[model samples]
Target chain A: MARVIVDVMLKPEILDPQGQAIARALPRLGFSGVSGVRQGKRFELELDGPADEAALSDVRKMAETLLANTVIEDFSIRVEE
Target chain B: MARVIVDVMLKPEILDPQGQAIARALPRLGFSGVSGVRQGKRFELELDGPADEAALSDVRKMAETLLANTVIEDFSIRVEE
Candidate 1:
């Protein structure tokens, strides 16, 4: 089975409180030099067939319709060998 | 500023209810051919310096201590150019 990866991230203009919290806690834990952080979602989909153009197109539709809330997030899809 | 990506995924044996839920919904929505789905988290870190060895080391510590729960999850780190 082929694997498709979909990364769904918040829009650049959106505020990510979870990411900010991590950023704030880094220095306290002695891990510094991180200026910012943005949290997102990643999905690994195992397809029943090869990762051809048709499969990619299907994945794109799935990502747009369910995997991401397009009003606030953007998603990118790629096939992993 | 350099960007580092940390991908945190649940262990293969761990239960992923959220991903399963999505997988169940896909076929009903007319998007088929997906055999399995696994959901995870993606974090983008904006570093204050170049993505040198030291910065990567620091990110590894960050991932182990804060970004991932080692018991049931695993994380991978990469530098995004």
Candidate 2:
């Protein structure tokens, strides 16, 4: 089996309210000297076989249809042995 | 300068409600055969110098203070040249 990692993040042009809220709360949370906070999502998938083109295509479709909101976010997938 | 990547995830024992919700919505979103959806956070930081002990300490403090909710999450930091 292979391990697949997917990262989903809001596009730079999109306003990430979640990230903004977290950034605003940082100082109050006792953290100092921190500036940007871009929130994103990570997914780990245990694939049934070798990491191949077909698996990649399925994963990409998964990201587009469910894992990410393509209208506001972008995603990248990484595969590991 | 160095690039630092931080990955934050819900501790295995902790229930990830957001992940669960996303997993539940996947089928409706047209993704089949997706069973798990463990969500996490990623932060990319461009440090002011070569990644050194001091910089790592600062980043750790940031993770503990703001980047992650210690009660439910664990984090790992990776430094890239």
Candidate 3:
């Protein structure tokens, strides 16, 4: 089986309160120096066969449809050989 | 700013219905060949300065506290130089 990796991140313009919360909490925890934090997602797919164009295309469509909200997020895919 | 990448994934024994759903939906969408799916999370911290050991240790503590549930999830940290 092949592996498919998808990385999803929020757009820079979007406000990520979760990340901001991390940034703010850091100082309190005595860990200063972190300017910011951005939280995202990663998905791995174990395909039954080879990682080919058709599988990639289908996964892309799936990303657009379910994995991400195209309006405020962006995603990239990498298929392992 | 330096970057800290955290990769979080479900433990092998845990059930991931969300991923299973994706596997089931793929064939219906006319995209066969996927054997399994696993979903995880990634957090990127844009530090104000260099990614040192102290910063990493702090982030690891935070991961244990807020970022992940140690019960069923496993997380690893990578600090960018």
Q: Between 2 and 3, whose lDDT is larger?
A: 3
The CA root-mean-square deviation of candidate 2, after full C-alpha superposition on the true structure, stands at: 2.8
Model 1 stretches astray by more than 4 angstroms: none
lDDT, residue B67, candidate 3:
77
For candidate 3, lDDT tens digit of each residue in A1-81?
Answer: 789988889998999988888778877876767688888888888977777888788789878877788999999899856
Each candidate's chain B TM-score? 0.97, 0.86, 0.89
Sort every candidate by TM-score, greatest first. Answer: 1, 3, 2
In order of appearance, the predictions have TM-scores of 0.98, 0.79, 0.86
lDDT tens per residue, model 2, B1-81: 777778999998989887788777767776555556678888766565666888788889888877889998999999856
Best by DockQ: 1
How does each model score on lDDT? Answer: 0.97, 0.79, 0.83
Clashing pairs in 2: none
| Candidate 3 chain A lowest-lDDT run of ten | A25-34
Better of 2 and 3 by DockQ: 3
- Give per-residue lDDT, candidate 2, residue B15: 90
DockQ values per model? 0.97, 0.44, 0.71
Interface RMSD of 2: 2.8
